[model samples]
Target: MRNVSRCGVVMLSVILSAGLASPAAAKEPSSEPEHVGVLDAAVESLTGDVYAEPSRWRPLSLGTLFTEGWDQAWASPTRGSGGAPRQGWIGAANGVFYRLGLAAYSYAHDVGDNGDEHAGTLTLYTPFSRRFELRHDIPFVVNNKGSGNSYHTNVGDFSIAPRVILSESQDFTQSFG
Candidate 1:
């Protein structure tokens, strides 16, 4: 189409002009590793602090809380199960998606009278190819006697499920093995 041709030409010209106007990148990287990093180190030496830090970062010391910028690191509270594993179900279907995954989740016994039963399971999904996938589940389970007398913790059984994907789509994916 004429319009598509014109758009392509315009894009090509813009890209070529941008390349010509800008300085060429260095063949060798800087000894300092990074430019902005060097500037940050300079500023930190002169001011004893940085203008800002990444989110979830905590201050190094309370004495310098307000004086020194919060540059130290702190792990996020919601990163994992948040101390207590989540009790829920999750599912996904489609294309290449994530080739591998690691997840931690918990389950509870719902059947007849049983002491509080909880299990923390680490589920790993490994895809060997677009059509083949393998899954492994390792669990650490525990049961606390309602009698207020004892508790048990043990390494639960492991499982493996090999799947062969026949078709995959946004709404549907069929697999069997």
Candidate 2:
């Protein structure tokens, strides 16, 4: 019990002194609005459910390609039975997390307004350390559509990466269950 009290006192003193000594901490509240304003604008412009929609609105047969920045990118093209083809694209660059990106695809046969679909993505990223990093501008939303009762369409994905790597590395893998 005595040891616990001592530890508590030490922690409290350290926290108080650190706060008092930090200029950034003292000035932080005033600048918080700027960050909030920027985030509001971003949230307003990029709207919708990112997962419910396909990345591409047009077919790959139409020769549509998405172009963006040096941060990130995602593209997926797929074909299945009794449905149209699907394509997706996602990407991001500049600003907070350095760069982040994402892309995926799904195809349905029949229903109502749903059919085949695909999506691509690009992500820009920034790292805080070798074992941790941040990602932003997550999903740009490449394409989305269907012939039946499909309700998938949205854009703008933001994320953070503890560790970043490329497809060449085994850090990323997928499994179906």
Candidate 3:
């Protein structure tokens, strides 16, 4: 996360310096602007207009946060790339993601062992990137067979899988990892 912020700052600075380093305007008599750092509000004014009109396929109330958000979700071949509205469900190529859900878990044992167990469970999916998704499950424990503080909890082991998009088509998509 710290790396992401540092990279963003560097990128933004490069864009601002390049965009604002151009020659001054000839007709600049708009009542001396206030000083804001080095270039007043001039730099801000120029950068604010970077985005064009929203694509017809999708409109955004806000920018996609860390490249994780919804897209048009339709597999179309006509859409372009880069700041253009997506035309398919392949929304993000590389970014962190999280999914929270629930499940019903069941278990049974022999006559000499524990009888049976049925409980709700919480499933959390944490992705380091689009290529690798990790899942941790927490079961609702009615009992823990007299274990310690940590073992007495309802926590379960994690299941991790590295994923990749194997193929994409106008009709469908495939992934493997």
Candidate 4:
């Protein structure tokens, strides 16, 4: 688990460094104002392209992983397709239509004997309209402990989050649940 965490950190650092180095390599001046950071610049570049030409945008698909056809499931919702920009303090929704996410976490503890814990969460987000969205999370957990190496597995608490977009603008977006 520690090694995995370390690897993730290293990968993130490499990606950020690469983005930061690109601006310096270009050297040419741009018409747009400078951004505060590489992440900010990247975000602006992506959102600008996405918002500017909605028709050109292609939905991401999983190639029949969850659906029968090539473009049936996992298609990104169009920006103006009955939902807001999908951006706010929560995070970029990437698509306003629907989204599915899976995340895993692991940890080692030394309380009495060396123990390890792992958890995986599956989340689904669906936007009903411009102002409202529903999110559900299901989690599973595993624990291993003691010299006997006993293992315990169980389902964690499931949760639902309802989000509302209060305000949105070119500068920022605000939302709450």
Candidate 5:
């Protein structure tokens, strides 16, 4: 579990920094403006004990990952990249439950290309009650340079996720991602 989280952090760093190669903005004598950091939130649940001890838990999770690059850009020679903080989140709900959310925040300087990056997403799911299930997630990205920084973003891929029940126990659940 520790290794997986570390890998996720590394991958996110690479993606955010790739944007740092662009031209730097003209130097301004005034104080640099500050922008608000991104915030992400999410919620979820499993049929049985997804993270339960006896059953060993697993589930196919689908959600947007956020990245930020601001803290890194400031040290650049050309202001080649610099921005504000960033964040992200993932969550789900069904007829049985409501308002469940799960979320994560970007590290201070994880923004990839030398600019601060921020993002958020919303999703809608249908019970499909039984075993098979379907879900859709709409994701958004926001990268800010500062108070008046330029913006770069995308709605991200519209994907279809199909979930199957592999195993379920009274206190645990196991599924594949």
Candidate 6:
């Protein structure tokens, strides 16, 4: 623990010194067109694409929370069969991509003169393609009964799902997995 604390302090000091030394190293602002409205500005900032077209704009889904790219339909000149755009799977941004996410949760309970219990979970989401995604969870538990104390930890379940887009229009999109 002492070594870990020393390492953390050293890393923080380095970072702070580097930032302070580069106070004037900021990039020059470019002459780009300003967004039209509040919503447009917010979307542009979040997507990191100031030139994204409004016609191809889509709402931010679970998948797009990590990355953004060009729509598959516009990637090629030819449309899908029947001249309709190829709708990607649910949570997709209309192209092949992958994303990884980590999240943590904790719960605690206590009862008078009885015992105390605590639980924690760590979840991971790995989306490997436009159509398939995987999810896994790991959990641990602790309990204190009066004077005696016990701790337990274990792995949790995992699942995979393949998604498909059923129908999509300018205003609505439906998908299933």
Per-candidate TM-score against the hidden true structure: 0.41, 0.24, 0.29, 0.42, 0.34, 0.32
Q: Is candidate 1 or candidate 5 better by TM-score?
A: 1
> lDDT values of the candidates?
0.44, 0.35, 0.37, 0.50, 0.35, 0.42
Q: Candidate 5 on 103-164: residue-level lDDT in tens?
A: 33333354555566666655544223223345556565444455455655655576656543
Q: How accurate locally is residue 25 in candidate 2, as Cα lDDT from 0 to 100?
A: 60
Select the stronger candidate by lDDT from 2 and 3: 3
lDDT of 2: 0.35
- Collision count for each candidate, in order: 0, 51, 0, 0, 23, 0
Regions of model 5 farther than 4 Å from truth: 1-113, 144-150
Model 2 alpha-carbon drift over 4 Å, by segment:
1-113, 145-152, 164-177
Question: Candidate 1: which stretches are off by over 4 Å?
Answer: 1-98, 105-114, 146-149
- The deviation in Å at residue 115 for candidate 5 is 1.8
On TM-score, the leading prediction is 4
* Error in Å for residue 113 of model 2: 10
* Cα lDDT for residue 128, candidate 2: 31
TM-score for candidate 2, please give it: 0.24
Q: Write the per-residue lDDT of candidate 6 for residues 1-111, one digit (tens) a residue.
A: 999999999999999989986855564333322324434433333344322343333333445423432222111112333666533454334342223344455555665
Poorly placed runs, candidate 4 (over 4 Å): 1-98, 107-114, 144-149
Q: What's the C-alpha lDDT at position 57 in model 3?
A: 17
Clash-forming residue pairs, model 3? none
* TM-score of candidate 4 against the unseen true structure: 0.42
